[model samples]
Target chain A: MHPVAVVNANGASPIVFVCEHASNNIPNMYHELGLNAADKISHAAYDPGALGVLRCLVNEFDAVGVYGTVSRLIYDCNRPPEAASAMPAKSEKIIVPANANITPAERDARTNAVYVPFTNTLADIIAQKGGQGIVITIHSFTPTYFDEPRHVEIGVIHDDDPTLASACVTELQGDGSFVCEINEPYSREDGVAHTLNLHGTKNGLQNAMIEVRNDLIATPDDEMKMGIYLAQQLRKTFKSLGIDLNEVSA
Target chain B: MHPVAVVNANGASPIVFVCEHASNNIPNMYHELGLNAADKISHAAYDPGALGVLRCLVNEFDAVGVYGTVSRLIYDCNRPPEAASAMPAKSEKIIVPANANITPAERDARTNAVYVPFTNTLADIIAQKGGQGIVITIHSFTPTYFDEPRHVEIGVIHDDDPTLASACVTELQGDGSFVCEINEPYSREDGVAHTLNLHGTKNGLQNAMIEVRNDLIATPDDEMKMGIYLAQQLRKTFKSLGIDLNEVSA
Candidate 1:
């Protein structure tokens, strides 16, 4: 199985689309996190419908897109390597039976087999793309976490790429249908700087993480609509910033 | 298939032994990283003999040990959540066919399945053992890396646990048989801080990562002997520091 899929537009454009929390598939071997059929269908097992949206976004824009294939529980693609949550996370207060307790040997094996290869693919994609590309990571967040209602419609996160995040925030805010937040709902202070830090900030690539409410794109139709909407807004923002979207494809 | 294995003496010992790179076994489905049988047995797929050494140490010291089951390449358990080498790595100068190009959903699945749960287990173990305990993370390093000969005998890595590291350094230095260096082989500057920062300094737990040369403990006999030697040294240091090694059993 290909650990990463890339749409190398190979143009002179200044944007790269990345989807970090895109998949929710456990290897058939792991089998539903040791849960029943219904539990497998729960939000705990997958990212609801991030794949459809990302697919649409990649198709609409001629940009390089990078994503992972295994479940985050296996190894969080977005977290730094040293963070406990980076591997065997306990977030959302759920216990993943497949990772409940592991031997050091087992941990190293999974890292070598799955985690390392996935990131390496991203790194290669970025290197091939070369300079002056904005990295936009696509993700989805639960509307209510821990049963607490989160009112923000969208969260635009950035570690230090405020230029792009601010521009996106302004464009998003212009849309009355959504409440645009700059690092709202979540902040980099929590120490989740994996894909963005590595592929974006580290390489001086302008970047931002866009989190849409899961319920908003839970279906194919919604995913497509949301994808087009985001693409248009991001594209317009890039144009205003004097960045040619077509140049990113070169 | 227990993903992680927790082994404790169940007698008396407050020492928590952590093996970061213990195992390197891939699932039978992965098929030795898509290589032939000869390549599978190479250090590429495994950590050589880290597990054997850890087992010997656990058995000899009657200590509580927490190990990760997945490979480090999937998601290095020792790395912080933000480190670039954390998850879904794709390029290690060699291609991992099984993880060549994956989707976003697959990445999340891996994180949820392997990364999150494993760290949670470590956190839970620490919590269960209370705040007063010594955390010793065991790891093995390649003797020859990138075709370069490494001369350091062992690496006693620490970020803020300088007291413990110093004691270890002093002990190793005193032994004339081995040319022990304090941080000569490796240092936190090379990303070792990823592990010590979170589990050790952040939680105020005394900890250090012990890197043994893989060549020295490649055999069962060598592993056992090394395990005993390390355990004795640790026991003596703990006693001098007025730390109770007997409080680690659950």
Candidate 2:
């Protein structure tokens, strides 16, 4: 099976969308990574409705979308290969038996299979956009984590580059509807911004990771609504930064 | 002792210089990290003549310079703490007995003592620049690594952002006086672009890491010459990019 799926690969817009935790299909080789039926479809497996939201954004703006197709428990595409969390032995309370004490060869095989292809696909699409590319990653967080509740409805996350995140937060506040925050739910310190840091900020592109509460994007309608709202905020952000989406490079 | 040294701290120039592997002092705390007199002074301990070149660039451009004052063998400021090479058990063929199988507490202590302070200082200075900063890290690499010979004299290295690197290389080629290459000797894959990726490109700043062969900058006179030559190349590069160094940020 393919590690990643590309949607709107030839989209005309200058924006690029990424959804790393988009699927929960653990291949037959790892045998569901020794997960029980309940834990197999849990938020630990993948971000609940991130791919749906990403699809909405891609269709709304005619943007390219690159999403991972395997469960993050197998090999987290968001993390670099060197990080232990990339192939976690345990996530939250769930122990991943297949990942525990895995040999270097197995680790390398998983990384090569899952992460390399996902990275290369996203990188190629973004490079095609040249300097005009604006990267926006889609993610969904559980409303509660480890029995603790989270108040943030929309997390406009950024690493060292705060241009897009700051703009999105300002616009959200101006709209005065959503509980938006900058770097909420997770931040660069939590290792959540690896995808943004590698693909967005490192490339000198205006970028942000928009993470919605999983409960907020639980259904198809909700995902579309959230995506549309984010699109408006991003449109305002680009205007503030003097970027025209329709400007064709000579 | 201070973990890092700042020269021209109040300089008004838009550029900021970083020299992470500047010193070979292992401090009295860990007993020179268990190295002999000759090994302590070798390239494995720190980058030889990097600080000299950095200082020359700072003086020439009236730019701020932040450099590590302790041996990279103690803690390489260029590397993130999670990286094993940050406190390497070995460098090249030389085994560092002190770094092998170190306790997490000892590793954290060294990170706090060396890497943390160095990182904070550079981050703070760059923040003060208000998006006008151009980060340039300087280093002098050994002419030979292991048993292999390296012919590249100067490496204009960059990570995902290649704007400044490409400009600098083009300008250097036009000058036709130096052996320059883009990401030769060491690339982002070699983990040499960590500092640039963290502080420079991530901040939406034009950044590049200039690597001079240690043989070319072995003396005070050689260091100044190389720095001046690099300064000229950077000036042309910035001009080509339509950045005026004299323009004060509003």
Candidate 3:
């Protein structure tokens, strides 16, 4: 079974956006870490309104969006199962009660149920698109991790498809309102290429994971504004490069 | 965390044998579908007497054995997550009760917990051996599928690394007691190249999955005899090919 979300639109749009870490919902079986409803609704549970951006992008551009339903704290959809962060030991400095001291049986269950389907979904979506569409993943990162402050306004990550990501970086850089980095503030070599490595490089697809500071997309308004900005910028960049987004068929 | 089963040697031998489908036990959480205890103990749960053969191989060759703990029925450790049979819809004509109508959350759990860790365990073993050891996966297959009878007494499955599998097939064919089929009864394209594709092809290692008729290895005596026969034939084949199994070290 495929793990990705498909928008079955027969359009000529060249881009498909995937939000691997768009949600952070813990299973109902997994309690709220002894926290209140408001705490659960915080950035800890979901991506703090990243789905709004995805929704806007789908409506504005002829594209599909694929995402994971479970929290990355359970099993990171963006990471390979072998990666340490795939099933992180901790999240937001709060100990994940269920993840502590996982047994072999427990580990097997998570892999079979979550990680496999998530990647399979992305692969199937790409296959269904006939391998011609470009892939752009939308994500939000915290302003800081532990005590380390992050500097870049936006980070574009790509493994084999640096062309599009580079163009995006250049476009955002030239814009006075934002500061953009290509494979920086964070980069792919740091093991962020897990999803792209398996789904993109393995299958020779053009893909990138774009990270926006969570603070920039913390509300519905912010998500919609950024979504429109990104869609316009990406479309302009692709157009300038003589690549026609409309040339892609469903 | 890696999932590994290691059997160390108490004697002076420098070889190690690996079995991919050594165990097939579904978790207690996934109750057996109307099957009795004896049915669970049958080939459906584990390779039919693979442990006995693997034990005999270790003794005859004086080596170590590393295997997976859970059954492939849960998630075939040998398959890539994208493969259809990685998590089969049915097992031995019996529907997997827990696997039916699996949600996205359930899919991620299985792939993250079971499939990834199992492959990681195998990877760690190969890395520790420093790429100097022979990797062989022992498996048993039914005499027939549906109503179609299989004629070959033995089959070797290989993906790109036809060197080892091909050699073994030649040696078994030379033995009058067995009819050997190279890359058959099933081909690598037949969805059995899980371990081979990831561990061998992706990592550039020499490996082969050996399929002995289930009936041939069902009994202890028969298992021991086949193990000895396979070990001797493999030794001869390696010698003829000038491949040194002992050269693999940490």
Candidate 4:
């Protein structure tokens, strides 16, 4: 499989959805990134249910998606190439031994092989949408972290330009069907908003990142239901923000 | 001036010279990277005499030249983006204060502004050359470092396929007028081979990087002399290697 998968290739949905930490399987060349089988499947390796939710979102909206086929531990597509954790030495308490001593050239090779393609594809898709390309990324987080319980059920993560996300949070709250907060559990300062900063703010496109609690999206039906809900909210949110999404003719 | 200066933009000479660490001035945006005036002019900032030699080579051969106009301390164009030294924190004993704590997005800003243009310009030039481009890079280093004196006058740097550099070394040695060595003071393992690997070897083009002693190229006359000598030797070397020089029309 390619390093990136572009769903609804011709989908002209102005609201482009991106799922960076979608896959947990490390590419064969990385040899599972020197992680044990359990670590490979852990939340540290990926956002377990994000891909399913993203696929549904893409299908429901006939929206475009750019996904990383390789695990984020090898190269986190969401992080900029210069981020220290782009290839992390440790995630939480688990050490990534393979990432500890990679040479600059080797690191660059991985960036070119993985990160570059995904970002380039995103840029191309946004460009294809012209002035209307709006970005919304989908991610999932575990209910507990480091043995501590987390409260927020859904997060509208954002960077400097928070119009899209603020609108998203407002709409999600109005629905009264979920617990929604702005930048909960993660923030741009925490290095979780690289995509929003680069693809959204830098490009002057309205964008937002959504983080769903992993437990709430544990099954396929749940993932799809949330995807459908988010898609409806996104359409309304875009309209509320004075942005019109020209749906692609599939 | 554009981020990259492509001298003789359409020159078709078989030998194409690129100068990566060609300038010492930081773009206006970087504000000299908080370096003192001395450090800005010192070897810690760039290959001082390399641009002179490159300009002369481009002029003499009527060949194409791609250059990085920003200080290496800001972004070393020769390095791959993932390189730790791409935005080096230190060079030798002097630490670069401005680079010590840059965010990934800030680092990528420099990469986007400085590094990308040079590489893209080189790629475009090579593509325009239409299958007859060969890569040759120009750089200069201090004759002494860390209280250790270096004896080599010229270093011919090469990547995996050393055909071009190996030939250049043989011709330089045959002249009996210069001291030349293969991979002296630097090698592929030193992370200096990224450009050669990407632009030369990966493109199936013959390529070499030449490093001259900084003292030898301290003046305009000195730079031009070395350039003329190298240009003449380059023509002979290309002929010896059975590579024809297709002179571009003025």
> Candidates' DockQ values?
0.01, 0.01, 0.01, 0.01
Error in Å for residue B33 of model 3? 65
Clashes of 4: 1
Chain A accuracy of model 4 expressed as TM-score: 0.95
lDDT (10s digit) by residue, model 3, range A74-130: 677777776766776566765565666777776767777788888877777778777
**Given candidate 1, what's the lDDT at residue A14?**
53
When just chain B is superposed on the true chain B, each candidate scores a TM-score of 0.86, 0.97, 0.88, 0.95
Which candidate gets the maximum lDDT versus the true structure? 2
Model 1, A12-99: lDDT tens digits are: 4456677765555456666655655544445554565565567667767756677766667766777765666655635576767666
Residue A189 displacement (Å), model 3: 2.8
- List the global CA lDDT of all models: 0.67, 0.85, 0.69, 0.81
Interface RMSD of each candidate, angstroms, one decimal? 20.9, 26.7, 25.2, 26.9
lDDT of 1: 0.67
lDDT (Cα) of model 4: 0.81
Evaluate residue B35 in candidate 4 and report its C-alpha lDDT on the 0 to 100 scale: 86
How many clashes in each candidate? 136, 0, 35, 1
Model 1 backbone overlap count? 136
